[model samples]
Target chain A: MDELTAELTDLYNEHYSQLLRMAVLLVDDRSAAEDIVQDAFVRVFDSRARLRDRDRALAFLRRSVLNKSRSLLRRRQVSRKYQHRLVQREPGPDESAHGVDRTVLAEAIARLPPRQREAIVLRYYADFSEAYTAKIMKVTPGAVKAYCSRGVTRLSSLLRERV
Target chain B: MTELDTAAPRENSDERLLREGLHTLVRDVEPSPTALSRVLAKRRGRSGSRLVLGLTGVAAAATAALLLVLVLVPDRSPRPVPVGIAPDSYVVRLADGTLASAALETGEVLREFGRVDAEVTALAKGDEHVYAAVAGEGVLRVGPDGTTRRVRGVGRRAEVSAMSAANGRLAVAGGNRVTLVSGNSTRRITLDTGLVVRDLALDRSGRLALVVRDRDGGAPTLRLVPAGRAGSDRIRLFEPACAPLRIAWSSTGLLVLRPRDCAARDAVRLTTIDPRTGGRIGGGVGIRFEGPIGGAGDVRVSTDSADRVLVSTATGKTWLVDGGGVELVAEHCVVGRNCTPVPAAM
Candidate 1:
């Protein structure tokens, strides 16, 4: 009913699913993906005073989601080192719920180094333009192109072998 | 591959497969309905919690009506002689972030305590020297002997954010990992919780405690990582709350400054805990202040007095707290040197 709530509702209704998918593709865990997206929205709401333009809300949310996902992945990696099997229960191999052969795709993307995986997710999975991906990743368009190329090359090799 | 863009190049088969495959993998996914509601509910809860705090500021008028009460001290036997730093020397951070220790009366820098090239971000002192985290660099030790050497095995490129030292043991934390160092044997410890490192503390026996914050805006946690030699038994401790920004250690116990209402952020409770088990040691003092301190300065444990603790803030506020009470011994001044009432135990 209020202005802030009304604006957030509209944004959430429009892009919540999109952002969730983006996080899922990057992090490869449904529960972690949902937390990452919610965390991003919380941050946007908390720092609403700093954003002057209404149009940039989506852009800001996207960038925050990417950065938070990167940090979460790094933290999880470090945690798994010491705690072993207790911290990370490996998901048994299963086919995609949508029948899209996502297990292989997920494994390949996870194998890519963090930055390349991030670039690939923003460019292809989220369907952002090169310039927009650069803005979200805080790199130049050329850098985005480079990461995507390297990531795509590696992913293609891995997926091809699965056939 | 689903949702294949028709505008793709006629060549480059790898790009096509990757993009099309990604679209198919996520095309059917949707956000949970409860997710948006949870977000809205959390913000509402945060807004409703911000109530203007009423503080019982420093008891000034009560000085005339001194209601002296006998203090009941704990019966723990006197432990081994605690290590680190001479009783009279004081350590502090200048306004520009340089670390220095001085005499109690004249504010003369006895010796600078870090490398100049890399700014000192975090500092902790031992008896002979001060162990400082040089921003993006690892740990550096500076002392009365004028010897400066980088602490090995703590990753030379590590941007260490927190350092805690007592006796001969040291623990340095940045991110989720903590490097426990004693002499030449250094061990890297990764906390089981996938949380960011907010603060770190170490007792004289090399017991480590870390304050880790969740990815969300929830209350932070204080987790004591159990450390002992091979085949030695250990006890684990974990306390979750919006912990204060600083944690100190003395011969008696580990000291934690717990704020009353984290949302209001006014009054603070000074508690001493058994380092091995997170158990409270004795009756503590309550301190009410107007605002938060600027940064973590230094913590000097009292060897002579009723085991009082001296803590300094970057904004030049020094406090002395014991079983009796918490007193503002200095304002706009570091401990030992130039502090009002001249901190007697420093």
Candidate 2:
């Protein structure tokens, strides 16, 4: 295999699952998240030469996955508006009481504005620094702080009410 | 797991719950075993298709030339031809931070309107002036005679995020506040605490169409506010799937340029919506680029007197879209090289 392909393969093996998980958190749909992750990988492959190194390629992959998830949400919103339909997922057959709580929390996270949700997921779930999160989101660090603060507060209120 | 989780510090109950919940939420998610192979196969397929497409295009071009001669040379029948009416000129911030008017048909810099600091973030054109929003500085109004002056009232340190102008008025947005300026009469409208303005437009009647996002959470919405009312007295339009990167008011309707999808780069869709009711007017045109055009924030659109739209990107590319179609009019700078006078506005 070529050097670029080999490097990408290594990066994919190491980070695909993590990126996939992050996509799931961002978009909430497992299949869509998988498609987003795969598309991101394909995009990275298409732009591999410009990426130059593994680190940049990985960063590009993360950004691409995030962008794709956001796009999916935007598309879904458009679909919901024009069609006047609601996307309701039925509870799985073996879903436990814990699964219900998880669903509620996920829904709350999903409801947060796009930036706030991104900030929350990047900071708490991905454990990124405020500076790094800002870098990824292309916003100021202060903005990231504000988003995280507002997101956490809203999530707390939402989860409290659900409980 | 990645290095991200390794350096995480201890968290409070809420933070801990959030982190734990996020982890548990995706615990069962994984890519199918064939995901990697599928990607590689798709890549190969795309590469193969490119060659096929290139060959097909050559054959199609030859056939089209033959048909054109056959249909037009001997047959004197009159056929309706689509005429492309290009805008005369439009304003853009050059890579060197200079704002200039460039001819749409010739790609020539018609006139230089002076330069602002490199921190200028947004640009809008009024009836008698051009405006540039400088980061951490107020908006600078450039008159027709090339005089630049900072508009008063908006605080000096206001970090203007978006700006739009129409009729005789200008709308400047910073954080959650929008300031409307018209003939020395400036009115400020503060949005709800967490609502952030993404892009905005002003109709001929002075009505405002704002694309705003709730920082707390929810889809971004298009809202219509009356001319002189507070933001609270606004009507929420439908939340768009592809949030508009830029919006402009045309004679026909509100011109919205958005990514074809959320993950947009190569192409964008320009749609028209009824200013009063947020209903789609018609299937808009799709503007494609050679590659990604920066981010959504970097794309800007402006409508000329004839209602023709000029779309500019931070990557130094510009296109003029009219009833005929979208046409690439200028490349002020290269992508990675000398993109000095990037089109900040127009």
Worst 10 residues of 2 chain B by lDDT: B333-342
lDDT tens string, model 2, A1-163?
Answer: 8776677678779989998888877887777888998888877866646446776787788888888877776566445432211124564554333433676777787767666788898888788777777667665566567668777888999888887
Task: Chain A TM-score per model, please list them.
Answer: 0.84, 0.85
Kindly report the fnat of each predicted structure, to 2 decimals.
0.35, 0.44
What level of docking quality does candidate 2 show?
incorrect
lDDT of 2 by residue, B21-115 (tens): 78877777778999888877776777677779879999999999999888885766798343221225567776677776666544566677787
**What is the CA-based DockQ of model 2?**
0.20
Instruction: Please compute and give the TM-score of the first chain of candidate 2 against the native first chain.
Output: 0.85
Of the true contacts between chains A and B, what fraction does model 1 have? 0.35
Candidate 1 chain B: minimum summed lDDT over ten consecutive residues — where? Answer: B297-306
Q: Taking the tens digit of each residue's C-alpha lDDT, what string does model 1 give over B1-346?
A: 1222344654376666677778766666788869889988876776555322112223533543354333444557878343344443456555555456653323345555543455666666665667777766678876644467788888777867677776677788887778888889888877545566766777666676666666555556566665663221222334554455556654456667666566655556666667667656644566666685332232222321124466555445556553233445456555344422111223
